[model samples]
Structure formats: structure tokens, C-alpha cells
Target: MRTEWSEFRESLRRWIYFRKVRFKRFLKARRAKQEDRLAKRNAPTLIPEGANIRQRADPRQSKIKRLRADFSNDLEETRFRFKQWKHFRWMRVRHFFQAVRTRLADMPSIIGFFKYLLHKRQRSIREQESLSTRKMEAKASSWSKFRSIYLPEWLRRWTIGGKPKSVLLAFLLLTSLVFVLAAYPAYGLLKALRAEQLLENSRELHQKGDLQGAFRKAHASYMLNSETLETFRWLCETAESINYHELLSWRQRLADHPDSGPQDRIKLVRTALDFHQPQVAEEAIRNLREQEVEPSEYLYLRLLTTLAHGRPAKNAAIRQCREILSLPAPPLEAYRIYWSLCLDSMDPRFGREAVNHMKQTAAASGAVGLAALRTLLQLPFEDEKKQRLYSKMLWEHPLAQRHDLLLSLRAVFFGHSLPETALRAALGKQYDRLDNTELQEVTSILNNLGFHENATDLLPTRTMASNKELWVEGLRARIGSDETKETEKVLMEQTPFTESERRFLHSLLLRKNKEFKKADEELVEALRMATASDLPILRKFVLLHEDKATLVALLHRLAKEPAMQRWAQALLILTLQRGAEDEPLEELLGAIQANDYRNNPETANRITRLKVLHGQDLVACRKIAEGLVARYPDVREYRFTLALCYQESDRPVESLRLLEGMLSANPSECPTQRLIGARALLRNGFSSEARELVVGFEKINLLAAERRILDYVLTQTKAKQKGPVLP
Candidate 1:
């Protein structure tokens, strides 16, 4: 049935083609005949004029005769054209059956012609294959010799018969074992290169303030190349910098590492407690128990483990300070750890007791006093005695350059003014002693605390030019505050800045100058080069230009790509949420809840946040936040959010306690914890501390609204305080 239908269709197409050809011939013949007839009709018809030479000479009779001849020629042409149209209209109908018959008669000839062509093509293909085989045999050169000697049975047929695919499978199978055995150096090099790349990404994440991601990548680098001392050291430092849980994984390994020393063991034990891993701390203590160690070191290890693990550990940590100081010679870490534990208690009794103990210790060694003072000064009280002690210690510890720097950093952290000499002196000494990450922290502290000049001076000169990360930071600062005359020139220099980012900045300038049309054009070009990092910026630009079409286009394009699908969904969700697109948003949420198989933590976080915010139910919000906190324990932001929910739910004490742990764990980071802690502190009547906390960020760049809130909080805290004014 199918074959018959196909033949019928072919017959119909042939009939149409034949009719067209016949019409062409018919038109050609008809036009030729018409031309001859028109020529005869149009030839001047000589008619005798009514009888006279006078009549022949008159112009009226001549004009009338010419008009008649012209009309006759036009009529003949019209009639001929009509006849041509009629013939064409009837051509298909009149020749249909005749065309079918002719096509049927030619079917055998058409089939025979195709068969002839097929035979010729087969002969040509055979000749080409023979010629190709001959060429392949000729071209089989040095590699064939190597193959025959090394894996003789594997590829013998390929070379022997000059036939491709003859023994490739066998070749691969035989070569696999040998290559695996021989490829270590090459594999090692590849791993080293990949580790370096991951380390660079870690640095980028560090700059972006994604501490979780940064440390994760840094650890990944170490995992890739565990033999590299630099990578291992980087993994340790990054973990320390962010107070990450990965420390738990590497703590025991580090202790067992050959390069670890006595000091490293003690520090690791203390860090374990700081990371809130009491079990690891206890294990370290036990591990040290079987080994020979100094009495003071053993005592301190026992002290840390006791302070970390029970309900009374807080009071235990405070009471142990006296015994810790009574030793013949205390470990230098003892002073700092004792006072830090005191401050972490957030109790007045512990603070005063720590101070009393500190006075006895401070007179003996300013270094020890400085260690105590460093944690003590962060107490946020305007105590006259603490000030007097700080001033006295400044003179007493004249040789303690690094400690003085620590004291200065504390002062700067509270936005206190420092003498130029003291600031530079302390920073210069710090530059010599600090690690790379610590230097970045100090620079950031100096910068955010409004000592921009000191911060600028503190940037590491050795790697500034070569480190792309540092260069980017310096470039941002320069672009933000370069000499006015050089702003355009600085913006025009495009190295290191992505094209999309550069154009985005340029578009901002255009927007500032009220060049709306030009700004939109620049943004369109920026959208063309938009990267994953630039997605949020692209969305903002699109929104600014009211370019809904551009965003929808992005959504569509990103949807088709597997790697980009996650981002596409996120962008659409954000856009829909912003626009209050409720129906589609609900649909999206339903789809995600119903069957999303990706299992991405980030996507889950966003969805949970979206749901919690939309529902606006405190109970539901707290429940979700708690779940998120438990599931994503390493994500500091989620923990902070959970703290926030606790605070909002009127569990101020719990919230403040959690904040204290986080702040003690990692003081340099944890901005979110600080904010929530400040508010909780105020509500709990620790207004002085809250004031100091909120005021600490005043000099740092903040949004206007945030600055206003900080000022308001400061005013309220100051109103509650009756202590001596700060100098």
C-alpha cells in the first residue's frame, strides 16, 4: 500500500512537470504566430480617399485612416492574448491523461538509468578504497614499528593488512596496563596544575567573603597534592582563617605530620576547642597523655579540654586562670587563652576576676599583660582602670613591638584614633610577623576603620604586582578614590576587568551623566558578555533598563544548557519574586517541591528562604532556619539567620550565647553574627557593649540606611550608659 501511494505521488509530480514544459512550448508557438498576425494587421492599410487630390492632401482623412489602423492592430493583439490565456488554463486538464501515459512508458528507462549510475558509483568507490589502502600502507611508518615491538598482537592486523579498526580495541586493552604504570609523572604534573588552579579559585572566594567556599577549595587543593608543603600549609591557614569544621578532618593528620612541632601540637589542641570540637580536643589531650611533655603544656591541655566539655566548664575555665599563672614558667599561650575564655563568658564576675589575675601577671611581663589586655579590651566597657592599665602597659612594654601592634589593632577596631607614629610603627612590626591572611585582615581592619593611608601602606609589596587578587582589590580602591583628573583614564584601562564588568561600570557613568539611550546600549553589550558571576549584575542592569525581553531571552538560553540550568532557575525565581509574579512563582515552587532531582544545597537554601519570607510566620521561619542551620552547619550565614530567628522569637539569651560562641570562634569574620549580637545585647540591657559593637562599623563603608540604624542604636546605648566617657 505504501509503495503504491509513493508511486502515485511520483506520477503526479511527473505530470505537473510535463504540463509546465508543454505550456512553455505552447506559449512560444502561440507568441510567434501572434507576432506574424499582428505584423500583417499593423502594416499600413492603404485605402483610397474619397475621390480627389484635394481630399488626399487634407490632413483630417489621413489622421482618421491612421486611427482606424491603430485600433485594428490593438484589437487583434487583445484577441491573441485572450486565446493564449484560455489555452494555458486548459493545458493541465487537456494533457493530464496523456502525461500519465508518457510517464508510465518512461518508468523502465528511469529505473535502468538509476541502476547504471549505481553501478558506476560502486566501481568508483571500489577504486577509491583500493587507492586509500595502498596510501595507508605507504604512510604506515615509524609508529607501526613501535606498535609491532611493544604490543605486537594488539595492532598486528592493522599494520599487516592496512585495515583501520582491525585491532584498535585489542590495542587499547593491551596498552592500558603499561600506560597506567608509566604515567605517574605526567599524572602528578596534571594534579599539581589542577591544584594550583583550585588554589587560585580559593583566593578569589576569599576575596568575595565566601569563607566556606574558600576553605573548601583550599582543602581540595591539598587533597589533590598532599605532598606539597605550601598546599598543606594553605589548607591549615584557610581553615584557621574561617574557623571551619574541615579543621576537624585535618587536625589529627596535622599532629601526625612530620613537620609538626611541639608548638603546633599545643596550637592544634587549642584550635580544636575553639572550633567547638570537644571530642577532638579530648582525644588530643589523651594523645598527649602517653607522650612526654612539659608539665605546663600538659596542664594547659587538660585546662582546654575541661573548659570545652561540660555545663560548668565556663566557671571552670575562669577558676583555672590562677593555677595556670602559678606555674614556674607559664606557656605564652596560657595568658591569651585564659583571658579569652573569661571574656567569652560575658559575665562581669569573670571579667573582674580575669582583670585581678591579669594585674599580678601584667607586672611581670608586658607580653603576658598584652596578651590578656588584647582580649580584655574587646569587652566594650568604658572602664577607667582598663584605660589606665593600657596606658601604663604602653610605657612598661616598650620592647613589646608585636604586642603593641595587637593593642593598636584593638584600638583601631573600636574606631579609636591613634597617633600616626604608633600606627605606622605597630603596622610595620606586624608586617614582619603576620601571615598572608593575617596581613589581609589587618589591611581590611585598617581600611574599614578609616585609616586608609595605613591600609594602603600595609598592602604586601612583594606579590602586589603578580597576584591578580591583590591587584583587583587595589584597582577597586584606586578606581573608587583615584585623583579626579585620572578617573576616566583609570576606567579606560581594561586589563584584569572582565569586559562585561568594565562596560557595566562605563554604563554606570553614562547613567550618571543622563545619557539614558547610550547607557542602555552599553548595558546591552554587557549582557552579551555576562558571566555566571555577573548574573546578578546583569539582572539589575536589565531591571534598570526595563528590559524584560533581555531577561526572558537569558532565561530561555540558560534553560537549554545542562550546566547553566541551575542558574537559570535561580534567576527566574529571583526575577519572579521581585516582580511579584505570583502564579508562575507558585508553579515554580510546586515543581521544585514535587520533583526536583538536583539536590543542590544552595538551591534548597534559596527555596527555603523564599518560602519562609513569603509565609511570614515566625514559627515556620524559626523551624526552617533551625533545619537549615543543622543541615548546613558550615554555612555561617545560615547559623546567623537561625540566631536571628531566635532573637526575633524572644529567645534573646540563647541568641546572644550562640553569637558569643561564633565571635570567639572567629572574631575577624562573622559580620552577620555581630549585627544580630549587637541587637540582642541592646535588648538584654548590655547597652554599652551593644554601643561599642554598633559603633565599630561606623567608619566602615555601609549603606545610608544601615548607617542610620547604627547611629540610632548608638544613641539608645549611650542613653542607657552612665559610665565614664571614652577618651
Candidate 2:
């Protein structure tokens, strides 16, 4: 059916071409007949005698008239043919058929092109085979010549027959087969070569600090030939190229190679970790364990990798390292690994468990294990239960001969009730057994816990030499309730109080039954000593006082005291208005102006009422505020204060402009700023924008007092709407 349709299309196309030619001939014949008819109609009678000419005409005149008549006939015929050709209805129909025929004729090429393509393919295969044979023959000849000349004596005995070229061809064919067999090997070598070249180049670039480019080249070599162990080795070496997936694949590949040495596998595992592929490193280490490699070394590498990946894997790493440490014939290195994992765990219970394990290990292993147990106990175990376990274990163990451990446990349970008796009980049995150092530790712990005389039982000679103030302070902590001490006095007569010493003394003084006068004297003495050392003791001094006079006097002294002067000056400005008697506001303001701390000058001015007061001196205060505002212009407080000062001194317009800038720059102006701004706007006769600003503030329902501002703005808005209430 397809073939018949195609033949019909070709025949239709030929018919269309034939009809087009026939139609052109018919049009030519029709136009010629029309021209003759027109010539007959337009011709003068006896035009054939026109060459004789008229009596008044010369010879050229007759020819001219004849030419004119002929030209008239030609023009008429041309017009008639042009009019007939305008529509050309038949040509349009023929063109449609021609397009159809042309489309149909092209269809065969489109439909059967695949079938015809087979013939071209056959020719290509034959051509290629012919070329391949010639190539094979040439290769054979070259190989034969190379083999004869270059092959060793034993290789020469392998007979190859026929003419040299035929023998050469056969020899070459065998040689080509050998090469084909060796293609993968050659590919492997080339890949290694490329990798080595890349590694060298990358090393140079890495030395030159082009890490990213070096990573790219090394990555390309790894991708191209990654089947062999060397490729894996290079991939491992170029750690930055080992992305998460490739690292996993290399780990799998390395695991497949059982012959891989422990050191090499370890190197690869480290490489995985360097690439941030902790999971792969973990898997490799596990594989090493399964292969009966040294568990201690690999487990440590895994533990370090897990930690480097962060705390999520810490528990698993701890478990694995513990397994290694638990081995009967464990590597000596496992002890350190176990110790490290314990340090990183941060769980108090784990520390206790570790100490418990150490206890057992020490009984079997001696002082080395006991020393490990002691180190474990030193980790910060804040929980009482954990400390109790540590103390109980130490008391039970024969190797735990150190009374210092029990005393350290007592220190851990100082104030809160954690069976200090139990620690004492344990130590009492071992009291005679302890060395002098252990006895001192026990004495100090007991003394600090306010069992001082009992501590004296442990070390009677040590009691007489202790610091009196420390002894007294410990007594206060152990005996006093806070209320009785609040009325008591504290003194620093014997030794100057450190900050912590002062805190303890302050708390001691605030306790019930403490002498108030003595405590007061102590606080003052402490502050004096603290000031000499440049302590910021004023804040503490203020916390202790209620009467404003004492605070003011202390602040005045502190402000000029040099050691605590700046902090004293700044705090005096902030807190003075709240407590201090009305000094000349100028004194406070003058101290602020002379102050060196620019970082918090705004804080100083805020407390001084600098922006609220109006005077010639207020200009200086405003200048400082403006300088601060200019520095941190985004700060609305500084800007708002400066703007308000401008308005208060009768520069209302400048104030309004400044307020507008502040509002535009920071639309979320606080309620205080909004209130100041609206007032400034009203005073500047910008009653409309002021009403808008006020209405905006009202919408937010900032404060109950803002209703008054809203009322005033509304009154002005209504008045303006009704017509201006002119002055």
C-alpha cells in the first residue's frame, strides 16, 4: 500500500508539471492572438503603403506614424493580457496540486530513509573491515621486525612461517592479541602515571597554597581510574577530593583487599577522617577489627574520628574503646584510650563507673591501675550521689590507701548533707594508716566544713597555724542563718579581702547574730583595701546601704579615689539622682564632662537631667549629647534628647525637623520619643503632621497617658478641619 501510494504521488507530480507547461503555452498563444486583433483594430488603412509617405511628409514621417500605430496596438494587447492575468484562478488551483504532489514525492525519502540507511551501513562496515585488515597487516609487519630484532634468543625459537611480511603479519597478529590482553594493565599503568603526575602537580600547588585547584586535578585522576588499590591510595591521599560517597566507596574497596597491611589500612582510615567522612572511617576501623588487625590502634583512630565529627558518636566510640581496654591481653595503649574517652564523656555516673573499673583493675595490676583510678576521681563530679559512690569505692579498695581521696570526697560534700560522717568514718579507720599529707587534706576539709576541732583531732599541730579570718568565716557559714548576719559587722583587719573574700564577708555580715557595727566596719575596711587594689567595690557598697547619705559620701570618695574613679563617677551619675542628696547638678554634670569614658557618655547624660534643664550651660550638655548622637546616630535616645533641647530653647522648627529625621530613620520610635516628637511638631505649628503622628501613636495604644496627646491632636485636627483657629 505504501509503495502504491508513493508511485501515485510521483505520477501526480509529473501530471502537475505537464499541465503547468501546457497552460503556459496556451497563455502565450492567446496573448499573441489578442495582440493581432488589437493591431487590426488600431492599424491605419493601407499601412503597408505607409513607407511611400504622404505628400507633406518626409520618409522618416511615414515610418514614425507606422511606429506610433504599432506601438498603440502593443500597448492595448499588454493591458488586456495584464488584466486577464490578475486573478489567474487556474494557476492557483494548479499550485495547490503542485504543493500536494511535492509533499507526497518527499514522503518516500522520509518514510524509507531508514531502509536505505542499511545499504550505506553495509558499505561502511566493508570499508572499515578493509581498512582494519590493512592496519592489522601493517601492525603485524612492524611487530615482526621489532620481534626479530628485539626479541631475546628464547623468543626467536618460536617459529613464525611464510614470507617475512606474512610471518610478520602472523607475528604481529599474535602481538596485537597480546596487547589487547594487556590493555587493562596498560590502562591501569597509565592511570597510575596520570595519578602520580597529578599528585606531584598537586603537591606543588598545595605548597603554593592552591588547594582548590589541586583538589580538582587529583579528583579527576581518581574518578578516571579508581579500580586499583593505588588509585584508592591516591584518592585517600588527596583527602579534600574524597567526598562523602567516594570515601565510602574507597572504604568498601579497602575492606575487600584482605592483603592490605594494618598500617596502610590505618593510613586510609585517617584519610577518611580527614575528608570528614567519619562514618567511612568508622567502618574501616571495624573492618580492621574483623580482620584481626590491632584493635587498640584502630579503635583509638575511630574514637578520635568520632570526636572530631562531634559528640553524637561519642557514646559508640566510648563503647568500642572500652571493649579494647577490657581485653585480657589488651594493648597497653588501650589504657590511655580508655582514659581519654572517660574525660570526654562528661557524665558523672560514667566517671564513677570508670573509677569502679579502675578499682578492680588495680587489684589485679598494681599501682599503675590504681593511679588511673585516682586520675578518674579527679574529674568534676558535681552530683552528690556520684561522689558518694567514689568515696564508697575508695574505702572498700585495699589499693586505695590514699586518705587524700577520701578527704577530696569530703570537700565535694561540704555544705549539703552527703554523709560527711561516712567520709569521716572511712578515714577514722584509716587515720593511723594515712601519711602526713593525707591527714592535712582531711584536716582542711573537716575544718572548712566547720568540724574544726574534730579536724584538730586529725592533725592537732596544724590547728594553731591556720588563718584566723578564714577560720572565723568558715564558722559563720556553718552556724549562722542569713537574717541575724544582716545586722552584723564584718572587718578586714587581719588581711585584705579579695573579691571572693569580700563576697563571703558580705554574706557573713548579712547573716543573723553577726555584730552589725563590726560588720559595717569590716565592709568599709574591705572596700578601702579593695579600692587600693582598684576593685569595683562601690556597687557592692551601695547594695549594703539604705541611707542615701552614706552612699553619696562613699560615691564622692570613690569618684576622686583614682583606683575606682571612672566606674565610681559613671555609677554616681546614674544612681545619685535616685538616692544622693541634691548636690549642685553642675557637680554631677561637670564630673561627667570631665569623664574619659566616651563609650557610655549617653548613659551618664541620661541620669544628669542635662536635656531637661534650659540654660547657657545646657548648651555644653547638648553638645555632648549631639556628639554622641552623631557617633551612634541610629540611637533614638540621643537624637530625641538633642531634638527636645532644640525645641525647649525656642528653636522649635529645628527641633521639629530633627524629630522628623529621627522618625523617618527609625519609625519604631519608642513611646517617649513619639511623645516628644508629637509635642515638638505641635509647638512648631505643624499641627497636621502632629495630628497624624499622634493618631499613629494612638493606634498602637502605647500607654494610657497617650490618650491625652490623642485628645489634643484630635481637638487640633477637628479645629483645622473646621477651618484654621488662627492666632
Candidate 3:
């Protein structure tokens, strides 16, 4: 068994040795292939030594030699060109330097000039060094003096003694003293600066119309420096200007201050007089008079005191006013007081003279002149010529030429008999300068004056679509005119109105043309997209509905809305009354009365008419109608109601008289008034007069009920056979 095992082992060893030698030979052959590939990749091209000579023996060799010769010649030419280029560059540089040298040679030696500059630089450096040394010496001397004065030898010894606790305490105490001394002045300076900054901010805030913020800032400034008279003066002036409640307190402060100057006292007195505290103004004036006040100032205060206190010394006050005006450049306050006294005395000549003088002085008197001019414009002169003259003078004044002044003029004289061209010129010239409020006022004035086209033209280019209703009113005014069709054409072409406004305006135009159904449909669509402000237009459109039930239903829906409640309720009541729904009419009237409809004249009139229609309380109806007539006499509807009340109360003569006056004033304007007048005439046995009135109605567009009444009146007149009776 041992021998067999030995043989197997020997076989295994031989197999292992054979495998190892085969693997070794494989690796060596692989390495040799890789080396060969590397050698081939890196090797240079090789040629036989006689290959060139063989090529040279051929004709192609001569071509090769010629090519070589050409290449050599080109290289030589390139080198020669490069050398010439370098020579040319060097010569140009040399010529430039030679020109500079020639230019310098005509002036001064370059080296000597440089030497002089160097000398100047050295001298500057030396001077700077000397200055620095002198500064250092001065600092040293100052330090020495400080040490000699403040730091005694004993104190220096104590500092150097190295008693650690004592040294730290002394250092701390001295540092605290130094900090306290430095910080006290710095704190005062910072407070003063802060107060000054606040004052500046207050002025800016006041200019921006932030009166509350300005008051706070001004108050803080005064609190920080109560001794500053200017700060106190500003606080007082601002308080008075903004009508702040603290005005009295600030004025008292200024008056009480010992350092208050004559100007401060004068201001305090003027503010007192303006606030209607004559006693306070008198005392202030007395104090000022004691302090050597100006003659004009004293006399002005005296005149003001006299005027404010009911003119106790009227003649003396007038003489004082005259004295004040006699001064060169008399105070504006004097002129203002004199004008008031003249007005109170009913002296038109003197008042006119004062106004003329005020106008002449307004050019140079700043705010005072503007105030005087405003007062003059507000005067109630009966003569139109005088009014026009005053207005013209005001318009010509430089102070009155401001945009704000123009707005003030419009406010004061919008409804008065001012020249339209002059007013229009003034407004148009400064239209671009108006702010939003002023612009809105101008547009409203233009609209009220029947200048709708001008108002439309003056609308801002960038107005919001939400304000299209205002522009629509202008367009509504153009309806039925020659421009109406052209306006509609232009509106169709342009999109100035929003989709809703355009629809609403189209509905309005359609309604004017009597296309009710289409207009109603368009209006419904518009109302769906309409804002609250658009409800009035919608209400007017809804009122034009021929279908009473539909109108009532629509009005009922609108009445449910809080914003449209009042108008819709009134409209609904009228619709119900017109439909002869008396049962619901009483409940609606009670609801309206319960809801405080008396505050509105239309609703109250409706209530009165309902009462009259019911005949429940004719006396109460008459009283209410009379009250309405008295309250709004200019309102034709109220007067018509009163006429109806008079007719219903069996006073036919009174009713006829009222109706006749109405007819005379507004001939055929009010159909209801004409109808009532015919009824009154028929009842009063003036059938011929009734026939004459009813005949006028045939030429007008009358309602069915009105035409029936007219026909009945004409038949009754014919039956009576009354001929041409003048009642």
C-alpha cells in the first residue's frame, strides 16, 4: 500500500510541475507580444541609405531639389522682412523720442527740470516732516503742561505705588468723573440735535397734511427744549392752524414765558382774537404795549379788540385803524379790521375802497393778501357789474392764479352769475394742475352748468372703469342732440365703457327708442354685473316698464337690498298705488313711516299721497302736504302735492290758483300738474278753461289715464256749451 501511495504522490508532483512550466511559458509569450506592439507604436520611420540617391537620380529629384531651394529662399525672405519690420519699429520709436527731445530742448533741460521737481518734492516732504515734528512737539508740550497741572508728584507716586486695590479704585473713580463730565454736555447736545430734527420733520409732516403727526413731533420738540422761543412759537402756530384743542395751552405757554418777544406776544394776541377770547387778547395786548410794541402792531390789536368786543370804542377804534393804515406798508390785519368795520357800519364806499386797497396789497403780502382776497370775493354785492369786476380783479391777482385758488373760486361762484367764458378759461388753463378732489369738483361744476361736453372732455385720460357712470351722465346729456348718433357710433368703435356700462348705456338708448323688451334684457344683464352705484340708473330704467306687475316685482327685489332699500321702497309704493292695490298700499306706507321715510322728501310725499288716496285722514294728508310744500317750495312735485291736497280738501279755488301759477311758470312741463289743473278747473265750473287746458294735452304724449281725463274734460265742456270763458 505504501509503494502505491508513493507512486500517486510522484505523479501529482510531476503534474503540478508541468502545469507551472506551461503557465510560465504562456505569460512570457504574452509579455513579448505586448512589448512588440509598444515598440511598433513608438518606432520612427526607417529608410534605406541609398533610397535618397535613388530618388535623386530620377527627374522627380530635380523637382524635389527645386522645391527645397524655393522653400529655403522663402525662409530667407521671411527673415529679411522680419528684420526690416524690427528696424522700422525701432526707427519710429527713435523718431518719436527725437521729436520729444526737440520739443524739450526748446523749453528747459529735462534732467534739470526733473532735478527741480525732485527738489520741490524733497522740500514738500521736509516741510511735512517739520510740520509733523512741530505737531509732535506741541502735543508733547501740551501733555507736559497737562501733567504738571493735573498730576501732582504725590498723585503720580500713589499711582505707581502698586497698592492694587487702591490703584484700581482711584482709576475707576477718575474714569467715572471723566465720563460724567463728557457725557453731560454730549447728552444735552444730542437732545438739542434730536429736537431740531423733530422740528424739521414736523414742518415736513405739516406740509404733507399730516396734522396729527406734525402735532406730536412739534410737541416733542417743544418738550425737549422748552426755553427755545422759536420752538414754542412753532408749536403755537401749528396748533392754531390745525384747530387743535391744545392751541390755548400752547398760546398760554408762549404768553407766560419770560423770554417771549414782542412778535410772540403779538402772535398770542392775534390767536386769542381769532379764537374769540377778547379778554385774553386784551391782556396780551396790554402786556405787549408795555414792552414797546410796534405802532402798527399796537393799533392793529386795539382795532381787533374793539371789533371783537362789540366795538365798545367804535370811533376810537376807527381812528386807530386809520392810523395803522397810514403807516408805510400797513399791516394786513389793519386792512382786514378796517374792512370789517366798514362792512359793519354799512359804509359801501369805504368797504369798496378797502377791498381795492386789499387787492393792491395782495401781490406782496403773501398769505395775508390771499385771505383778504378770499374775504373780498365772499362779499355779497348786489350789483352784477361790481361782482364781475371783483371776480376779474381776483382772477388777475398773482395769488389767486394758483390752482387751489381756482378751486375756491369755483366753490364760491359756481351757481352765481360769473362769466362762463372767463371761468372756463381759468379752469382750462390750470386743468392739468388740479388734484383729484379739484378735478372732480371742476367736472361736477361743468356738468351742473350744462357744459356736459366740456365735462366729458375734461375727464382724466387714466380714469378707472368704476367711474364710468360719471362719464355716462355726460353722454346722457348728449342724447337726442345732433351729436347723439355720432356719440353712439364713436362709443361702438371705442371701449371707454366697461362691458356692463356699455350694455347699460345701450339699454338706455334702446329704451329711448321704445324697444322695451330688448332694453329690459340688456339691463338685466347689466344689473348682474353692476355695482351698488349703478342701481339708480337701473331703478330709473325699471320705472319705465309698462308692465306694472313686472315693475312691482323688480322693485320688490330691489327693496330687499340694503343699499337700494329706500329708493326701491318708494318706487314700489308708487307702483302699488298706480296699480290700485290699496290693501298693500296701506301696509307699505306704514312700513315706510315706521322705517323713518320722513327723512326723505320723496318717500314722505309718497306717504302723503297714499293717505290722500285712501281718504283715511284728509286733514293729516293736507297737513303733511303743506309741511312738504313749506320745506321744499322750490320742488315742483311738493307744490303739486299741495295743490292736490287743496283740491281734495274742497278748496277748488285755491287749487286752481296754485295750478294756474304753476302753468304760468312752467307751461306744459309737468303732465301731472296739468292733469290736476284740468280737474280743478272742471270741478270749479270753469269748463271752458278746462277745455282750453285739455286741448294743450292733445299735442303732448299722454298716458292712457291722462288721455281719458282729457277726453272727459272736452266732452263735459262741449256738453256745457261754455264759449271762450276766461277764468
lDDT of 1 at 19: 100
TM-score of 2: 0.29
Q: What's the lDDT for all of these models?
A: 0.62, 0.57, 0.67
Better of 1 and 3 by lDDT: 3
The better-scoring model by TM-score among 1 and 2 is 1
Tens-digit lDDT track for model 3 on 1-727?
A: 9999999999999999999999998997677667666755575545466566334232223333565689999999999999999999999999999999898776757778898999999999978966765665566776774565335645756667557896779888998999999999999999999999999999999999998889889999989987788888888867876887668667877778887777777877878777666667777877775547767667767777666534223445667788887887677667677767766642243566666766676555465666666666666556766556656656666666444345345444655444556566666766457655666666665554445555556665445344554555446445523255655674685545667656766766776677889977976787667766555665544533345654665676678789678767877876775565766777666555522554444566656765664554677777777876664454556666777788777888888776656553444434555677777778778776666666666677654445565777777788765644444
Ranking by TM-score: 3, 1, 2
Residues 127-209 of candidate 1: C-alpha lDDT, one tens digit per residue: 99667656755767767645633355444544565455736666666688789877987898899999999999998998898
* TM-score of model 3 vs. true structure: 0.34
Top lDDT hit: 3
TM-scores, each model vs. reference: 0.31, 0.29, 0.34
Q: What would you estimate as the lDDT of candidate 3? A: 0.67
Ranking 1 against 2 by lDDT, winner: 1
Q: What TM-score should be assigned to candidate 1?
A: 0.31
